[model samples]
Target chain A: MTTGVRRRLGVEERRQQLIGVALELFSRRSPDEVSIDEIASAAGISRPLVYHYFPGKLSLYEAALQRAADDLAARFVEPHEGPLGARLLRVMGRYFDFVDEHGPGFSALMRGGPAVPAGGTYAMSTVSTTNALIDSVRQAAYVQILSHLGVTDPPARLELVVRSWISLAESTALIWLDGRRIPRAELESQLVHDFAALASVSAAYDEEMGALLRRVFKEEPADGPFADLAGRLLTLAT
Target chain B: MTTGVRRRLGVEERRQQLIGVALELFSRRSPDEVSIDEIASAAGISRPLVYHYFPGKLSLYEAALQRAADDLAARFVEPHEGPLGARLLRVMGRYFDFVDEHGPGFSALMRGGPAVPAGGTYAMSTVSTTNALIDSVRQAAYVQILSHLGVTDPPARLELVVRSWISLAESTALIWLDGRRIPRAELESQLVHDFAALASVSAAYDEEMGALLRRVFKEEPADGPFADLAGRLLTLAT
Candidate 1:
């Protein structure tokens, strides 16, 4: 038994540990509901020690939010080898996994936590930081989707299609988290098909998007989500 | 002459006039930046008269927001029209008209006005009321879409497609207002096509949605947005 021994952590390590602990607590409850005392207790540290690492709860909340944002952004990354539809499905899967794991925290983050002060420069900056983090996540996703399309300079229509799809995926996830009524697998595949749908519509209006879709479709397997969407739409013709 | 006469107004009319004046002021600038004195002056009344009608700026702001919400909701209404696509296009057009007219107010409403207080039951209730108004708009749009589809009871998939499109349209408008690089007419039509795209993908997954799409397509003209979507997807075949 090593009950008597206590280990000392380096400055950065202690901070990271506290963030990790705070995030865990926040994952289960809204950040506003979880106090600094609870976070310190969870990490086996004194309240003063917690304050030593971070000035206050708002700062700690921001640190935890930063960690969560990074994790969320990483979920969008996938290998370039697979078909685009399949890649997007995997991304949605991981995204939902994160949402499922961090329910209240995710909602609080997106909806703006209950504790958010209505006024004050300090509170305003915190809100802006929170917004900036959220925007960064959206930007990361936009870049990832563009990379999947392999387009460095996208036409305006293409940009709209991509950006709109990202927003669709986001709202879908947020609403899904509310009741989770539909099967996750079905929503995942449907979202992948949604991308195809948005792109197809954009392609109709823009030659550049048309060309991009053709290029995307050529790489798709017959049973892939993109082809699957084609097969479904074709049923109407018969 | 008539110019020397001061027109007397009833209490309700005066209150309505104040709200209209406040809404006009709020449309151009964020509500926080607009003061009661300005509203009073804009209405050609004294500041005490403005206070008599409303307790504080927040209450008046809420009233303005309520008026805006009703106006926004009315934009979604279309008389059970010829083609769903054309009807949706009209809806989007009018919707964007509101966004275009109330640019700052629209942004401030959706983003939460900069002056929102961080805490206090009064402020918290205001936030909830604001959120409730926003949700009412979404719900109104949802009901309107369902009515256009002529479905009293929709499947989960159908609900998902409609709700997701609503969210997509919202985010699209919010993003569009930032720089408004694309032509508004094009976006309005694209949004109509977006609805078709979202539904088509859902139809591919659910037989009920498939049946609904087939029924919908039968009435749609060859050049309609729905058929146009089908036509675009057919291009991938060649």
Candidate 2:
């Protein structure tokens, strides 16, 4: 243990350190499976010291999940200079990176279980907090995608398309984490193509989406992912 | 309450009547909001009689959910005589009919909340049973879709596409149930179009998916949803 050589740390620094350690442990295993003792031991601190920073395991688990949520939300942030398909592909790449790194934790969070308080007074509130955190992440991703689309006021159909695509990406990741059967790169590109496909189908129904598609296609290069989707569809049509 | 002229029912008939009453109450409001007293009153029976058929509220909720789940799974069943698009549209129609009718119960079931036993000895097990019921419904829908495609062995990408579409439909319905500003008919047809869109995008990535798409398209008439999607894409291409 590093207890023998423990260095002084500020309160904020210690809390951050503890959260990092807890997240590390929680990532490897479900949060419910981890304990305050384990976190303290991993952090080279005492259980009492861990309690001094966070009241209980639930608070500590929320802190770790908060950090993970922020990191996940950040993965959707990309500059709007490149083609949307490539930007989305990059986002998917980083997204899968996080999912790959934290399989069990991600599953538990998405499934809303195992980490939740069991048969306690705080169970319902904790469940809602977990769901709120998940919803916030989805909202962040939705806003980021809308920003990339450059639409301040998305039509109802466009909104449906975006929200549906976000859910598709989420479910795709959850299923992929179940078994890494399909190649990651293919899934990533296919997700970008899925965005195009969703938008195009919506465009067929709404004039605004039709116009949006035209603008999107006008910016896409011949070798970009959107063009790639178009080429495949054209080939199939022929 | 029909208490003035109660009719005798067999044991099996009594249980079935209780289940139907519970489902009706649960559908009108969240299951947690409806109580044993209300259920008994609705069934025109005593609380002890209700308990005679089921142990507690959780078991009764499960029985109700089981009936709802079976009804939902059956909504996906269609004769293999028509175009895939028409068949899927019919499925979406009936699926949304359930969502529209049982808004609160469907939401609670999907979100995994409220109706669940709150911080009790049976809470965890009840939650898992609720989840199991939801998963079973998804499994039934997935198997039904694969059967519709007539594929005994679906490749990984095809599987992903199908599973992702199922999730998409679910999320779409959930979101639509929130505001429901968009016309129900539009969303229903769009969901069918979404299936074609998702499958076609996957086709671009895998030969198996590509072959599946060709078969799907060959069966789709010019005026069908699949052809409509093709028309939209081709219009954009030119």
Candidate 3:
């Protein structure tokens, strides 16, 4: 007779379960509003068991956030098949969808809190990894587009364009999430169109830059950290 | 000897004093972190006097915020002088400078929070005003540019473009305030260059647009709400 709690789960499985529950609670309230006792009770687990796993509420919150962040960085940064514009759109969509799905959590993370919560340290390197990936892709795409269009500008201009695109995309997503201005489909369509306008201006593929991007897309295994991240995201989200 | 404190001030003068003190305290900490006691003490006034002038901390905070918002709305929404690009750059610079000068207060206003003491109520009209002004200016600019160019896209597409530009400008400002890699001068130059790139594609009647922009620039009045907001802002800072 197999009981629901009879089957033993591995450490990874239990850890994942803890993170899953934590994410939901964190998303429901600001950081200051959530407490470990609430999390433990909601999870139907003992306080001691929760403490053993997370050390503290802050540690638990950070761990959950890190998992989500790493999952996103891995998915978006990984090289993939498709035109640079298409690839960029897909990555941006993933991010927007994440925010849309987890509104309060995203708000807390981006806006931060009154003080650094005990567990939530300012992890610059972790966040920068994502930013750097975006910069690199943007630079490559910008160079490709500008060269094709016969616009003579320094490589730095490409950085500015890409960053601007990112800034706009982020704000747009945030506003959409906050305002519920349109249905999700309409919002995403508008986002794609807006992205294409900017991308079309900056993603003209020159021979050499195209070749470099192609190589980056090919040499790296398709099933890399990015795919892993996507897989994790699916597991948590679905 | 006519001591500065001896003479009874008018309603406007007293209101200004309360707003100044409120802005100063709100900027330094979350509304929850501040107290009426602290505000009165800091302003060199009695607690009862503070309450007499303004019902509560929330009212004082909103009054101060409303003035700032009104100034920003007038500047960004109302007609201004100069080329659209240059005008936008100047307005954006002013916005950034305002944020830089009164970061704590600005930050508090930007991040809408739950009514912290029993009397405090969260209001986000200031952010809305900023968005509306940006939209208005961008829309007017787009119409002029498109009419000049004699090319047409659907209104939706135009909205996307304008929204994209405004969002980028705003998010760029946010990043700048966050003290990220983008310096003020570099951000300005990049924004101008990108604006040019877009305008070059979309703009027509190069000479006419320039002339009209110049006239608009000349007509812009400096002695307005922005000056008033600045004056009020300085009072709060001390």
Best by DockQ: 2
- Candidate 2, superposed: residue stretches over 4 Å from native: A1-5, A114-122, B1-5, B112-122
lDDT of 3 by residue, B66-152 (tens): 666555445454243444445555655765666566665555444332234443222333223433544454555556445433346
In model 3, state the lDDT of residue B199.
Answer: 29
Model 3 chain B, TM?
0.60
- lDDT per residue (tens digit) for residues A93-189 in model 3: 6666676666776665554222224443333333333234434544544454444333565343344455566566555665556656445554554
- For model 1, residues B65-158, the per-residue Cα lDDT tens digits are 8999999999888999698788888899999999998988888777633353324223566767777888899999999999888899988778
Flag regions of model 3 displaced more than 4 Å: A1-15, A22-63, A80-90, A93-164, A175-238, B1-6, B10-13, B22-42, B46-63, B80-90, B93-97, B107-160, B177-238
- Best TM-score among the predictions, by candidate number: 2
Over A188-217, each residue of candidate 2 has an lDDT whose tens digit, in order, gives 888899999889888887888899989988
Model 2 residue B174 CA deviation in Å: 0.6
In model 3, the Cα lDDT at residue A131 comes to: 37
Better structure of 1 and 3 per TM-score: 1
- Write down the TM-score of model 1's second chain: 0.92
Error of 1 at B122 (Å): 9.6
lDDT of each: 0.81, 0.84, 0.51
Q: How does each model score on TM-score?
A: 0.89, 0.93, 0.50
